[model samples]
Target: MDTAGLEILGEEECLRLLADVPVGRIVYIDRALPAIQPVNFVVHGQSVVIRTAARSRLAIAATGTVVAFEVDEFNDNCVRHGWSVVAVGRAGQVTDDQELASVRQRGLRPWAPGTREYYLRVDIEIISGRRLRHADAPAGP
Candidate 1:
């Protein structure tokens, strides 16, 4: 992709954008191969929390495993006009009763129909993003 119209976003801006989105893709290694799953999530402090089944691949991911969580928004009529944010971190299950209760209060629900009884939290170590603005778009204030 061309880099002329791309603007690198700072960590704070990236986190703010992430907070506005409800869905993101979680990338992890599964059986020696990289896999991606779309999940509904919420940003809790510096971590991204997602709900999944206990036996699901995501829930079973070993603690401290490095993973990538990405969220983006694009214009249908103009695909190039959009922004993407990625959070790289280690995956950890929310096993603490107090933490689980706090996360539950955020009402993080899955869009899929099924029993999602496990919560996985990704402790973000690095966050980066880029925005693609049209050539004719007005500059920021």
Candidate 2:
């Protein structure tokens, strides 16, 4: 798509958008190749927290491994506008009992059926986003 009608979102706006959504995709490297997985997450300060099975791929992600987490919303109507937010960061397992308890209080539950007992946290270092709208559409409030 063209960038003519795209608006670059600020960090605060990106975080707001991230917190507004419950599901996002995490892009990581697996076996020398890029792999992306859909995960339900919650925003914890500047980090994104996700719960997965102990043996799941996300739970096995190495500490300090760079990854990208993205969330987006699109309109399928005639207007056809959408916005996407992406956060790049390092992924690590949450091992601290105190922190884990705090995250649990936030109710970051997984929608998938499984024994999701492992918690992974992505420390956001970089965040960027864009909104695409029709050329003639009115500016968003």
User: In candidate 1, which residue ranges exceed 4 Å CA deviation?
Assistant: 1-5, 136-141
Model 1 earns a TM-score of 0.90
User: 1-141 in candidate 2: lDDT tens per residue?
Assistant: 336657898889999999998789999988788889998898998999988887876667635699999999876563457899999999998999999999999998778887888888999999999888776665563
Clashing residue pairs in candidate 2 are none
Reference-based lDDT, each prediction = 0.87, 0.85
Candidate 1 collision pairs? none
The residue-level lDDT of candidate 2 at 69 comes to 95
* Residue lDDT tens for model 1, 18-68: 999888999999878898999999999999999998888877763569999
| lDDT for predicted candidate 2 compared with the true structure | 0.85
Error of 2 at 41 (Å): 0.6
